[model samples]
Target chain A: MDLVLLLQRIFDALFNSAIYSSLALALVIIFRSTGLLNFAQGEMATFTAYIAFVLLAGPQPRLTGGGLAGLIPGVPFSIPLAIFGAVLCGMAAGAMTERALIRPLGGASDVALVNITIGLLLATNSLMAQWWGTGPRFFPAIFPTGAGQHFTILGARLRYSTVGVWVILLSALILLVLLLRHTKTGLAFRAVSISPSNAELVGVRVGPTLMYGWAMASGFGALAACLSANSVLLEPNMMLRVLVYAFAAATLGGLDSPKGALLGGLIIGLSQTLIPAYVPFIGFELSVLPALVAMVVILLIRPAGLFGTQRIERI
Target chain B: MSAQAPRRFTPVSVAGLIVLAGLLVAIPFLTTTTSLRQATQIVVSVLAVLGVNIATGYGGMISLGHGVFVGVGAFATGYYVGDLQLPWLLAIALGAITAGLAGALVGVPALRIRGIHLALVTLGLAIVFRPLSKRFPSITGGVSGRSIDARFDAPGWWPSDGRMASSVYRYVFCVLIVVLVLWATWNLVNSRFGRSMRALRDNHMAAAIYGIDLVAARVTTFAISAGIAGLCGALQVLLVPFVSQDKYPAQESLVIYASAVIGGLGTIWGSVLGVLARTVLGKAGSALAGYDGLGPLGEFFDLLDESAFVFGVGLIILTFLFPRGLAGLGRKNQVPK
Candidate 1:
């Protein structure tokens, strides 16, 4: 491959990985602590992005007064504020879902719990369609837009959005790492994940910690949604295919490890971008196949994933 | 007293069975052609649900890609009978066998990953099925899909003619196949292998320690279920006379799972009940959506147009209310709950 083409693919992969890692990280948070894969993670993220859109949407330059858009009066819809609000809203939604639905079904079998999440997925996606109608809506760009917003690196020009995505992803990672490692709540979360009964015995307040874990994970999911909406616009079904990719990434990384999620997401993102660019037969139409097939192959060889601890099955 | 007790059948139960059989046979005469076709579709759904029951309910393997098996079966039949001009009967059997082989391929991963993980793997299979179907233009007819001109017409002895004849022909075959499969499933569940399969589902480690070959049983169960699902697909194309990529989206897989769960997971009768409930409720939901009498309530009812909402709520409510599913309603010894 030419160096320019190779460099462009690398940059594209990095940009894509930023979004995938955010989602995979979110999935890992829930799986590590709750022992259940949040199948609705992507839908939850998209729902939060809709909240972001509602907040960011304002009267056009030609229009004067606003009704729902001017809820704060004279603020004229701030993108940063909307992003912040969406993240908080996502956290609240995640916490509410955990407390209201998942917690109540704690006694149900794993299969039942999984099915409930699937139900949640279907309900949430359709709710979006019913509420907003089933069409792609204009989502405002959070990054700067200009013709001169490109920099040549290794003979390939990178857009400002690419850099912006990386910045957001890195900040989210740092914030999560610091929170999990330093905070008392984080300690309690770790304690509960290791052993809920033991953590409860130690007065760690297991339920709240789990709720916190979900909240944090969902906040990351909202961020991922914002990053994704930057390119794809907003639609109810936008995240469905992305969710499959995230699942593949999570499986490849190790469902129980945050770092693994990040690394796995990068690997998957790179392969998905590069394979379609290079391979003659499989084009963009079958782009999703390689990553998923790779994940399955990895799983068959090492079921626990690259960085996950092997589960010891007791007799 | 010296001889063994004679086989006993209560008069009421015997009467109930006769009435049920009468109703089953009378469906074609009683309902319109469209309704008869819908009934055939429901039977096809029941067959698919039964496939789910064998693997998930009986074998303890959670599959989210049962629809893919059905799609494969449909595509197989479409290619064999439509393209190759093979006999429809032979095409259906081959389609089912092809689907069974695909199921076994999917089951190979189950040997490594299971539970929700297995579910995720199956779900990936479902997601991949759409694009994969598009890739093979010759077999699946690419994005446009393929259509069959050969109609399933009633035999010479039947009374109906024209479209009704085809409807009656397909309906008769569906009923026969449903009954045959149901009986075979009943026997399977009562047999030694059935007991072993149930044991494996309940506790795989214990079953394995008890001398059961876990891999063989699990893979075989998946194969059988896939075969049944494939048959449903073949019957569906036979009834509808067309097969397209749009016909079997990934979402349909979830709907199939919902049907199996709604029907009562492991029980054969539950599979039938679940399909019946889904078809009836689905039609009722659409009817409720079109009902325009209640002013603002009409708008509220219109949301029922999104069947996912109804089925999602149904799945949750049923999981909570009747863990054993709707068919478990009258049984005093319902398991799980």
Candidate 2:
């Protein structure tokens, strides 16, 4: 019943809401185009975060060991530049993954597609562990997070980092909206999402359009990872739990709806923070349980989700 | 019932069985008691993979959380044997039944959820299992897992009373149970119910039209599959005498599912082949990891030490090359879709 405390929790929850939204958006993009869930999305994003770490730290052999540090230039880059570079790498990797691993399947069974994505998840996860040790590393914050870096709103401290992340997310979203609404490639992507065969019939190049979608999705994932790395710490398994929340968000939003992803993320994020604060049994570590239960309930009762199109099955 | 053509065994398969039998017998003698126990554990893992095989392959429902059932079996068996002072065999049976009941509970939700959605739910279960198990300290041993006071040792009438004798006894017991389960599963898959299970998998609506009870078949398939995995977990406790939540990670479930896919899903032999492949790949990877002198490639070689890495790469390569899996290689028109 404490209004200020509740406001504080809600403000704190907004940071995670943005993160889940971006990751869920990434998932929605792929599902819309390819009708496949990228189980490896979290790991792929974490890998980019590591890349950004390497770029910022240069060739610190003690930190990176004999891993990927040797491959990069021996000069420490600025944080924004490093993140930008990592996002580009992430985009490239996403495009390549679709072309190499997914394209060859040519619409295989659900089992086969699941196998590929799960395979990628396992491989990338262990590869990261092998390269960088399993121990968590300290990642520098993008925004200034000093003791007095928060604004006082109704006696609650709203951190500057949270506001900064939201600004970046809104800008990126606006850019995405502009690109989708006023570009040839965006039209092709929309057409392909509606119907791949129809888009191909009109010569929109379905494969390349899907590839772009994957790239964009991966880019969003990279941004989420880099921004949140400082809070969560850098580790190989850092994103595993986050992936569950993101998946829940996507499912709640409607798997193939972009706006649903954003809304779902907001709801999931608020509940994730608020539920644990109120309920003693569902502690911090167990907050994911509610998201999962919500996902199951939604899937059972409303498969289409809030913003998604209902799927009609043919006998 | 209609008469069907008798099954034929290929010369290659006959030779394979003979070699496998020889290896199983020779394993205890050739290795130390420690390695012998490890070998027995590997053999026991086949049941878990087979569990995934039944649900994903024959039953046409993908279960990425079989490891949770295995954990349930181990934890339940430990509680029964240690706390209730039940006989080991009865405890093991009860443990499997408990896991089967749990599987049935999960299968109720699975009645409406299908394909990828079911996969998502199961994966969520896999991730949640560790934290959930940690909540029950008395049964699951909480954060650090508790050890069972009772040890599964050899009987007095066995020729020798040394540690090696007990190790050998456990090995033989595990191998016998694994074979018995395999034999039982082979028969189960060939029964009238098995045919209906397959029919439902291929097309549920058509199968339902043909008088197949969709709900009963799916739930039973999951229960039986989970029971098999539970048996594997019971044996794990019998071998190690310890149960921990750490043993059943989300990745472990994925690896188990990967093994089922890589080995060939539909065939029972595929489960064994998948486990064998995992063991061989793991041994080879560790051996290669021990070697030095590879300048730049040593880092890549280091990654080989992790079985998850090996299995991941193997899963992808196998998916590309042999979609039907290793059991499907060089054989045609045998495995049902």
lDDT (CA) for every model shown? 0.82, 0.90
The number of the candidate with the highest TM-score is 2
Worst 10 residues of 1 chain B by lDDT: B1-10
lDDT of 1 by residue, B1-337 (tens): 0111113544644674587588788998888889999878877778888898888888888888899999999999888888888888998999999999999988787887778888887877887788878988888778898777677777798877876787888898988988899889888877889888888888788889999998998888899999999999999888987888777776788878887888778776677777777777778888999998878788777767777777777888887777777756655555562
TM-score of each: 0.93, 0.97
Calculate DockQ per candidate and list them: 0.59, 0.73
Report, for all candidates in order, the number of backbone clashes. 1, 0
Off by over 4 Å in 1: A58-76, A145-148, B1-23, B332-337
- The 10 consecutive residues of candidate 2 chain B with the worst lDDT sum are B1-10
Question: In candidate 2, which residue ranges exceed 4 Å CA deviation?
Answer: A63-74, B1-6, B333-337
- Looking at model 1, the pairs that clash are B263-B274
- lDDT tens digits by residue: candidate 2, A1-315: 999999999999999999999999999999999999898999999999999998888867676533465576655778998899899999999999999999988888788888998999999999999888899989999899999999999999999999999999889899888988899999999999999999999999888888999999999999999999999999998888888899999999999999999999999999999999999998887898999899888888988889899989887
